[model samples]
Target: MRAVRSIKGRLGTAAALAVPLAAFATEASAHVKWFCAYDVAGQPRGLAEVLCADFEWLTGLALACLMLGCLAEGTPLGIALLNALDRVTTRIRTDTHLLVRVTLGFFFVSLWSLGGIILTPELTTDAAWIPWLQLGLAGLLISPRTTPLVGFGIVFLFAYATAQYGAFHLADYPVFLGVAAYLILTGLGISVLGLRPIDVVRWTAAITLMWASVEKWAYPHWTDPLIAAKPAMTMGASPELFMKAAGVIEFTLAFALIWTPLVRRTSAIILAGIFVSAVFEFGKVDAIGHSGIIVVLLAIAADDVRAAASRRQVVLAPAYYGAALAGFLALYYVGHALLFGGPAELTGMPVI
Candidate 1:
């Protein structure tokens, strides 16, 4: 009984803590590149600088939330939450593939209409064939028989963009590959490895968001001008602190997407809300760019089958979150250093 009460109390606390995090989440999903000046080749801030005291405190708080959330997963409240999610998402759950297809079809058609875009808004091209290719891909989405081909076309576009830009710049959008994989696997009626089509999309979306969160940490200065332009977005916090907190919140929620079923489903709902809110604040470019992942998150929220039934798995979630956090941070810093020379030196405080 005490254990049950403990879990309930922790769940309530976690829910309360989540409010402040969500308040800042709009900026977390707003594509910084769309509103800010960025250089793909420019050096990011050093890891030492990013891992400062404030960052450590935010990380600690995030970990606490993760622990509480994981513990809450075993409680009756968690099961109730999942049931509520399932009830709310009945329509989306019934038409998962249709949702993805229609969204992607609209997205591709919009891209075709826009013209001169490579894959995302920030990545532009002078090639005349790309818009027509987008149009062709949109046409392919008209039938499930040809949807897999649309997937292949998306892969080609991603590859072409990588060739035009560098791999590092393209890394910002691996969710494209996730969308492609979803289209391919769903159309073919097959699972790759052990994961279903939507499973692949869930994992990839988590990776994409986590990578973006790391970028916020490494290049917080890149978004300084953006915060300057839209001071209201900061909600009274200094831009520097806001960026750090946003990175932590975004990374933590992204990691939650891959956790036990209830945790991940709730996270998907929250992330989807964040992205949707960003679309409102950042407008059409945000909507167009984020359309694919938003569909994936919706699918994840509606997923009822894939789950961690083992209590032990839920208990170890914090450990997994910590290790994954460390691993991704290492990879982001080391990979950038290898690809784009060393980190930049800052003469003074970098937070504007």
Candidate 2:
């Protein structure tokens, strides 16, 4: 009994450490992309379309299963499955390599530079030099000695560029804020702060998803064009129904991230899977946009945190977090509509 108790104590500590790291892995708004719409005559006009590709129905099904699993995580069957996952991830956490970290850093930098993800609007054909600058940053990330500084620089530059597009518009893509937070936290985690990088990543992921979910609730019409383009997205339901359901699912999963360890990891897995599956349909842009989220998810999956108590120590109760998020969304959209006339008015910029 004493030996068993010791083992349990050690496992608890391991799980506590894992909680912070696992927190980092999650999808930034489930890898959704927004683009300006155009008229038949090729004139850039209308609100941006919330688009998805590559078996959206299947993705939805998977997310549903994930949600169900999260709800059942306290059950015996769920406990068994989570234990199995924990065992597998335990081996992985012990094997994290520097090469892998550098590679991920390089990939993100490349994506940013190539205009495959964030900054896509700013790094247009006219601004050729921007890509070159991003590429230079990518090169800097390849070295451990320089990774921290380069990461900070990248985040700062991204924030500056994002601000140029209009602070109000920034609310539309809250995932970029998550990305920026990840870069800053990772850099600080590596060099200056004792903060766990994965923890920072996880919080940003949750915050981004929760924030972006509001867009779906406040402006479901933004997704109408994407559903129209790919009728299969509706799965026989009306576009409005699909959009509302998707918004709820995304928001719930984001909330789950702060709920418990099993649910958080499971949500990250499902969210990452949805993002990855979309790459097959949306092509390079989807892949580039989601790469950072995927890498963070991978890190979370590999984390060996198994402590149940650590999950309870989170900042807010699930209900409180959900309510807070809803309140913020209400204020944001209502204020924007009152000021600009409608949410669609904010999307009047030209396609990049």
Candidate 3:
């Protein structure tokens, strides 16, 4: 009975998390939106509320990890790791276009098959046209000449979903826009601002992860049911502490995605592993929903672009991470407060 309900829970109407317990292992593990009603415009937990002692310690540890990763970037082991990664991903790097198209082709086709889904499992729609649009997008991926059309199609879908669901709710998946940009830029064979298509994708993926991590912090209670249902996920830690550590780990690793080559590639690989690991626990919903980003991460992992890393850059990474972390935290909390009202006292775990 427990297993049956768990399976049904994954397929239930997507909302948002609402508990004070252990949460999803990674941002991609369980979209809080999938299982419970979420008041996106509701008052979020204030920054003051979330800065508990545990949060402070976990953050400090995360900063240490970032500083160490930066130092390692200039070491012999880092160079060797990069070389080994390069050798393994040679074909993937060379055929990034094919990989993205093939992955997206299947992704859209799956959406078409599922029907009613906007972009993921939780965000559903009644419009009959949506599945057809997804099907059309899948068809568009078959030809390089038509790939630009596919990009435009994705933009339309994102815009339409934003209109239907509101921008804040839709904001959870900027990765779609990143995928669109990659398709459009690669298809058109033009470089805007001298940035490679893959680099654009990498940046957007980083942004998406960081933003979701903030959601984990602001709405830790939203995932309490998930934690309660899957207590083993907490690894014997209290649910609240587990959620805090998860958020810090997620945020720190996400920020690393934009660091030096060694750091970013390693971050990509670790993130990919985390997402994949989630599939075993959450099953097909996670696997299908996360497939596109997984492919993107693999491409990033294989990318051979060696940006010249100097001592100055390595020395400044922790500073950048701190700034980015502070900036995102402010954005999420203040944005919610301004859009909603003042922070309200959180109640008990919400009944889904």
Best by lDDT: 1
Ranking by TM-score: 1, 3, 2
Worst 10 residues of 1 by lDDT: 343-352
**Candidate 2 lDDT tens digits, 153-229:** 55665676555555555554444445445555554555225446566567777776776666665565555566667
Q: How far is candidate 3 from the true structure (C-alpha RMSD, Å)?
A: 10.1
Model 3 clashing residue pairs (backbone): 14-34, 15-33, 16-32, 17-222, 18-221, 18-222, 19-221, 19-222, 22-239
**Model 1 stretches astray by more than 4 angstroms:** 1-19, 306-311, 343-352
Cα lDDT tens digits, model 1, 1-352, are: 7765765686577668666667687875688898788986787777878889999999988888777667767577777666667778999999998888899888988888999998799989999999999998988888889999999999999999999998988888899999999899988999988888888888888999899999998889998877878788889988888999999989988998888888788788878888888887888999998898898899999998745556687568768888988998888877777776664332222323
Cα lDDT tens digits for candidate 3, 1-352? 6654543463231112212211345533567777656778776676787888888888888888677767766566567667767887999999889999999999999999998998888889999999998999999999988999998898999999888878887778898998999999999999779999899999999999899888888888888878778777787888778777888878887888888898888778778877877777777777779999999999999988987667887668767877998898877766665555554432222323
Q: Report how far off residue 317 is in candidate 2 (Å).
A: 5.7
lDDT of 2 at 37: 41
What's the CA RMSD of model 1 in angstroms?
4.7
Query: lDDT of each model, Cα atoms only?
Result: 0.84, 0.55, 0.80
Candidate 3 accuracy as TM-score: 0.88
